[model samples]
Target: MFRNRDRSAETPAHETALACLEAGIAATLPERVVADRIALDEETIAVGGATYSLDTFDRLVVLGGGKAAGGLAAALADRLGSRLDDGCVVTTDVESGSVGPIEVREGDHPTPTERNVEATRTILDRAEAATAETLVLALVTGGASALLCAPAAGLALSDLQATTDALLASGASIDEINAVRKHCSAIKGGQLARAAAPAPVVTLAISDVVGDDPAVIGSGPTVPDGSTFGDALAVLDRYDLRETIPDPVVDRLERGVDGELEETPDAGARAVAAAADDWHSLANGRTAIDAARGVARERGYEPLVLSSRFAGEAGEVGRVHASVAAEIVAAGEPVEPPAVVLSGGEVTVTVDGDGTGGPNQEFALAAAIELAESGADAVLASVDTDGIDGPTDAAGAIVDRGTVPRDEVDPARRALAANDVYDDLDDRSALLRTGYTGTNVNDLRVLVVPAAD
Candidate 1:
């Protein structure tokens, strides 16, 4: 939940927006999601539409890494109870702790680290130990690409870290970033499935990517990878990062492209093919967006879900949202007044300044300026569903027509130009801070336009 909800919700519209955001995020919590999507019967377990007999497997083990993996492992442990033999899950430091019988290990995110490597090795070890009689429950989610760090042969952790940092700063889409990641890592891109070969692996994922592509989510550790080493090289070229990123990454990718190294397992790969029917997406941006829409309707507002697949530059996306608000206020083109326009998807910000802020913060700042300039009587709030936007402590921010005073518009513009929206939003008391909300379905945005008087 937002820590400053009361302080930020100074108006009825603000209150409604905050409530929608809370509902949206709550709908994706691992505990809630797992409980809704997974069920245990007397002798069988059901996940989504698939059911497996518990007696079929002599051992059940969990192995995965991500921001939500710890929570997912805990919830699953409760459901499996004594049936679970042992498990290990690597997650972000904030979410790490012992969960029932599972060992929850801590790791970094947005960047890989030595801790991540060690924790991921433990996860891989568990996966590799599984036999034909074992049922491997893989709890992969957003952030697993970083949390489950395992450099490819001849690549060091530092090479991955540098590549990750460079790619993140390049304003690349999550799909593109993961394409590169799937090539550079040893455990990602169906390698985890290969490690647990002969044993049936069931992956329960919380999608944080656009299109809800399992192959891109968490770099598709349990699913077949559609990307190739050539694709990875193309990402670096597209981002102009080949020269800037570590040389070793370039070399490894080049080697793979030249057929000197094996490519990530594809759909035809045995391990991926065997478990093709078992990968389940527990929740996604649409799940949160729908929850937000329901809450908006309950709050006496007509809900208009824009899309759950919006992408591109964060500031540009925010401007588009502002234009929608302006249209609703002026001519009610998309919908009449008293509407809460909702959207959910990941957005990226290209960092050119030393200042700090995440995509949602940048979005809020841009939208705030547009709302003030256009004189739209509306409140807008955006937050990363995982509760951490960029490297900042604030989840995102909330703003409205009054967020920017007349004299400070230039300053606000400067702040955004410098990639310092976090400080500027904080100065205006617009930053929304919520630390690590248990799950990730990407970014959520709410725009509330009041009915005209």
Candidate 2:
């Protein structure tokens, strides 16, 4: 939807911006990052710090699920070729084949469906038979929680959907949501690693969670789980979401938390005890920094790559970025005018209102509000590499000085209140939309502060 009249070639600045966005998103996809981290030698695969020699293993197979699991599987097949044995991966963004010996099955997202549950079962069956002589390449990435759906015993898909919806609507942080997800799923909370016991499991991960906590990232399908049913119940209680949760599902988790039900295996569990697997972090915020730097340089602006581990409430984070921009413009403390500050990380929305936007959108809108109040001459854009944010279609939004109003801005406040940042910026043509970018590197934010006249 290029609405401008210019049909000429894209300028270096425009191209750089687009390229940065694309690269930032692609870098988070499991296949793109994992394949690069894993190398194939004469007879072995070296992933991260662990090496699995074909000479030592009878078979090498890929089995897992996530938004990018299929892509990762396809890439591994490309590298291993005929050497790669049978495997299946469940994901939301399925495309035409790029590799053999790996099957890509379509799955759901945001909430798990019956089809997702069934596909997850299929993957589990494949993992259960893994032997020590076999190499289990478990591809884990963002969205694994929804992609690899298998409800706990007695939990139903409808129940999961409702609970998931509440969590989304409740504005619970990703960590909190996934904590509950880990407890409710049969395969999460390191259960997948447990299922593949006796086998050497090499997990090539692309972290979407801040700090990349293996146990929390994608609900830690292959890592040892330290979260308990009590933790899950605590999230529900902390968010006051108990009423929204299904009774049977709550009862099941409550039982587990109360000790009537067995707890999920902890760090000392056999999966960790067996020493049968290794966790490999393949990619993270580095890509975003590189892309941002490239964009800023191309735009004739100084680029400063800050720590990408940004986290906290979306609005609060946006205000911090705005303050930095204002400081740059007024005093040049961090950098002179004509500078860009780029960062990457996941942010949270506390769900204070009925709004249609993700963390990125909320951040942009919030920053725009502050920029307007302070009369800051800057433009801010934040986006989720996965394309869909929360439940909205817009990737994110862009905010500039023109976006900020001089008078009391009740509209922006209302938008933020309702979590409807998209509507607030719709008139300005500020919403950034890229449907399903096939990757998820968490959140990317770019701030451009121009020089004063």
Candidate 3:
């Protein structure tokens, strides 16, 4: 399943690390998780621990957007067969396509575009036409925030693009970034459910945020939003983004905060109350971590799951992982050597340099430096589960004691400081490229420590 499996200068430990990462990524595939949680019988359809009878609705419509929406819809089509009347979803993956009654439309990611706006209009139109008798199966996941763009009144696609670019570059947390998105979008923050008012909407999600908050995932199109316009404005102030944000975005947010405009539906809103019992969003970081631990054991390494909610700056997290490996080698306090430590979560990078590198690349380079200084023999690898880390082509990077030569230590330090780890890793053949993994669950990090010699 790994595309870059063969490369020169391969170490046995490097191969093991690659296997561990591939295993974790594979475990989060949309088809695998969707099949496990969704199923159908003759007259009854089950999803996320809830059962809905086919006889309860006059029509079954599938609607959603995300990185995994294509696969999720495919799996549902297989199970639902002819019962599915129609379906449509937006995604960034070009390989995604329609199957049966579902059509997976293309959309730009990390930034909203005109094509995205047009495609989203169709989704909203279909949703708005739904009635109480329509059974709506909603797929919400990572990338949906951008893929399902529907700018609020007075805002253009340019406004959304500018705001998104600034927010992503500001190193803001996903929750904070999404709070702003929900308020500016017409279909987000429970508006989709409102559009399909009085209909029974069941949502199946693949979480990519740290806390797995359903309202934060894909900006909560089918779930109730707890954030308000005031919260969105606060995020901008916290990041000092008021000056850089487009004028229209600022105006819209300010107007909503002052009650001059309507707010996105909150948990107590009537729109959410109408379809409260019929919604669900499942699949999270733990889903991948659990599967990864199993793979570690199969590979003959004692596994230590650090935490499923790991967060912080990428470089600092990398150093901490190195420190833990050093402790295992020196004191054996946490666990003996020949152990694989696993963690999953999204990490941020505060970009100050014009260099090209993502959070995972910075993490690996910083960890390599720490391991070299501590004289620790360990292999550290990290990758965004989506197969795209920041604006780079490599999924992430891997490093070890021998990754940086003794004489080149100073140069490596300079590269990391300049945020140019991508060039350095590429020169050393350390980057891992698997293209788009067809699923996203934030990031997966692994530290492999050898047994004491």
Q: In terms of TM-score, which candidate is strongest?
A: 1
Q: Estimate each model's TM-score.
A: 0.98, 0.92, 0.96
Give stretches of model 2 more than 4 Å off.
1-19, 29-35, 95-98, 273-277, 297-300
RMSD of each: 1.1, 2.8, 1.6
- Each model's lDDT: 0.90, 0.77, 0.85
Backbone clash pairs in model 3 (N, Cα, C under 3 Å; residues 3+ apart or in different chains), count:
0
lDDT of 2: 0.77
TM-score of candidate 2 on Cα atoms, chains taken together: 0.92
Per-residue error at 278 for model 3, in Å? 3.7
| Ten contiguous residues with the weakest lDDT in model 1 | 92-101
- Which tens-of-lDDT digit does each residue in 217-288 have in candidate 2? 788888777778888999989989888899977898889877887666677787654432488777766665
Query: Which parts of model 3 are misplaced by more than 4 Å?
Result: 95-97, 274-276
Write candidate 1's Cα lDDT for 269-387 as tens digits. Answer: 98787776799999999999999999999888999999898999999999999999999999997999899999988889999888989999999999999998999999999999999
